[model samples]
Target chain A: MELLKPELGLIIWTTIILLSLIFILTKFAWKPILKGLNDREKTIAEALNTAEKTKLEMAAMKSQHEALLNEARQERSLILKEAKDMKDAIIGEARDKAKSEGAKMIEEAKREIDNQKMAAIIEVKNAAGNLVLEVSEKILRRELNSKDEQVKYINTLIEQSKLN
Target chain B: MCEYLCATKKRVIALKVLKFKLFITIFLLSVFSVSLVSAAHGEEETNSTAPTEHNESKKEDGKFNAKKVILEHISDSHEWHFFSYPTGDGYKDVALPLPCILYNDVNGFSFFLFNKLHHGAIDGYSLNAEHHIGRSDGEGFYDLSITKNVFAMMISSILLIWLFRSAAKGYGARPNQAPTGLQNLMEVLVSFVRDEAAKPFLGKKTDKYLPYLLTVFFFIWINNMLGLLPGGANVTGNIAVTTTLALFTFILILTGSRKHYWMHILNPPGIPFGVKLILVPVEILGIITKPFALLIRLFANMTAGHLIVLSFLSMIFIFGQMSPIAGGGISIFSIAFSTFIYLLEMLVCALQAYIFTMLSSVFISEAIAGGHDHDEHAAEDLP
Candidate 1:
């Protein structure tokens, strides 16, 4: 068929049209389109890089925050341990002070009781001695009524004691 | 989880059922339309032939030439023919006559509408039986008219320009903003060409030849798409068009070639002198065949696709000549097959464009790749 035949005029026209298309499109279309595409690609790559960096930063910050929290927890437990030890020491000192004061009061009471007992014994002894002396005085006064008879009897007794 | 799986399974079943229903509906509709069209054709043939028995004999003489019909449909013509309908006495051709510009040595140049040639002759120039313009004595003349294919090319180019210009404007308007509509689509294609086609082969030099690659890709792709439409010219299917495209690639490859490339072709390394004699011719042939293959591959592929679809459509008429019922039954299958081929052609449209661009870039890069390694080696030796 004539259709299979490539005509010269059509070939020339096609070449002209294609060349013009290439030239025109290269200048107006593909240039800008490619530039825009490259720009977008670069932007996307930069954005992804920024996101990765930020993610790393965020992870670092998160670990740092956990470390700081751990430090605060350790400090809080240490402070709690110190506070407990101080409270125990204060309570023990108060108990020891109270026990010493009770012991001192008991010693003072025992000394006072001993002093009272000695005083009472001394008073009893004085009273007994006075009573004995008064009895003896009365007896002697009653019995020495006859002075001569008594003196004679004493002389006879003294002579008999010298002969024997 | 069980619940969710059950819900998903129900949705899948529902979707399958819906798809089956849609397929059946389309099948029935196609069959119905086929029968209706065959019936109308049969009636028209019978009615027209009954009035004039002599005309019937003449019609039988011509009969149905499928090859001619298919070729005529696929070939570039002086006019764009849409579907014609039967009028009062005969079928009228519904077509747009393009301008015919012819030049010859004697008459110098002639300009007239293509419809003028339909009357047999104009200004000593006449359209041959094959619808080619020549001298009345049947001498070959140069035709520079805007035929169907050329018009299609112009239209496709204009469309490409408009589309990309608008897309470029969109990029300018919104520097970093997201693209919408045409800009979005153009960006995807542009990026695909840049990233997939040009970058891989051209490497660092992709920017240098990216414009040509992009233009060729979009031009071929757009023309292929246009060829698929009804009443559209087979722009990409024509050898002239493909040759022009291949010529551009050939030119680029030649112009971009470095000294190393010529050296490799002339005196290849690692080959004995006796072997070099055989290898050099083959290498030179290889150079010519690269673009030749590009030309033939695209032309043949696009033309074959169109031929296959046209053949499928032709089947309906071929079977209809046997019997109306046979025609009607075949029409459904033929139309279905053609529809499938049409969808496949859509993929081929983009694929061929991509292949052409990628191969062109590969060729150019190969031509320029000679001194690149030398430079790299030199740089390594330096530092």
Candidate 2:
């Protein structure tokens, strides 16, 4: 019973002290402390969120860059393929044109050679006929010196003509 | 892998066997020493008790009273008792006297140092067996002196203020920077009280009640820790201190309660009309019991811890009267157990403070919560 009793003065003092303590501490200690904690939390959360956003942006940019690089590679390969096909077509056209030109040039040269050979053969034939006529006239003039020899030559010429 | 597992298993078995052997050896040694000491103690007890028996027959001055000694040590006093030893004629008490303040209707006011009353009565007021002040003519007075408990409370309160003030000042100096030293430690405790204790229960109103919860938590925790030190007063163990704290909580709960809260207590929902007759009284009793339990729980837990440690220490003196060898042997075990309990009390110091504040916040929140239906409507009605 004695131990359970309360002292009035102590209670009064304690109440006074505790009330003042609550007021003073609430004003001085808890406000700034809670504010600081909240502020720091907000800052850290903002930092992390910004970092996450930047990382996502970087990933998107990286994928876009990869896509652009692939397009460039495709364009480069397409240009290369077209250039290769053009090169092959141009070479084929040039080779065909040179072959046709060379064949036409050879046909003209063969025609020119044939015309020259025909002209030479005709000239040679005319020269041979004139020479034969001159030789025959000379013989006839020598042989007509004697009538008998002439009669015998005429008869032999008639008989040779009959045999011909 | 199999081979390795088998080798490890064999090694483990060997280690376990060696540990068991060592344990048995220690157990046997302690048992043998205890029995030998008890045997020596029995002969000395008879020799010592004979003189005390003679002294009791002649006079009661020489006999030892353990209850008186223990109660005196645990109870509040007007002086701080450090230690006492035997002098040539009698035992001398080494203590520092505190101031005593008294006010009476007849005597007006009286103030003096406590040492003046050591010999006998002074100014019609004297200290009784329990160290309480009383008049020689059986009169009463208002005591407002600086007793050991009050002194200790003042010291701990001053310490708490200084600690938090410095921590708060540091926060003020560097508002957005990281905490260092004392600020860092205090921030942990403050945040713990807020997040773990206050925020879970109080919710949006946490800011409003946080100051009180923090104060109670730190006040109780600091005083509990201080009480564990040697020659320190048991402030929290005192009924008066706990009662005051309980009253504060009672006031808060009552004042903060809404109309719906009382309605629930008076006429509980979903209960039959006939049951209300029995339930209403029980509900009201429940309200009173809540704070009563708080008062008893803190006071009993703190007091029991102190009593148990003192009992362990008292064993050494009790055995020393029988024989010095028995006392020495028992001292080792008693002091070891006391040290272990002392460490456990340190953990209880923080745990009990947390429990007190946590429960207070829960009660306050429940009172202010009103009715769920009303709250839902209030939310819906908001623009």
The C-alpha RMSD of each candidate to the native structure, in angstroms, is 10.0, 9.6
Lowest summed lDDT across 10 adjacent residues in model 2 chain A is found at A130-139
lDDT of 1 by residue, B1-383 (tens): 99999999999999999999977875676567556456445546665644422121212333556787788778888888786554555345677988888887777788898878766688688765455566777666788888999999999989999999898887788776688899999898888998899999887778779888988999999999999998889998898888888988999999989888998999888899999989999999999999999998999999999999999987877776667667667777888899999999999999999999999999998897757476674354452
Q: Put down candidate 2 lDDT per residue, B153-201, tens digits, no spaces.
A: 8788779878888898876788677899999999999999999999999
User: In model 1, how large is the Cα lDDT of residue B175?
Assistant: 75
Docking class of 1: acceptable
Q: Which runs in model 1 stand beyond 4 Å of their true positions?
A: A1-3, A51-164, B1-60, B371-373, B376-383
Candidate 1 chain B weakest ten by summed lDDT? B52-61
The lDDT per prediction is 0.81, 0.78
Residue range with the least summed lDDT across 10 consecutive positions in model 1 chain A: A131-140
Once fitted onto the true fold, the runs of candidate 2 whose alpha carbons sit more than 4 angstroms away are: A67-164, B1-60, B119-123, B129-131, B173-178, B374-383
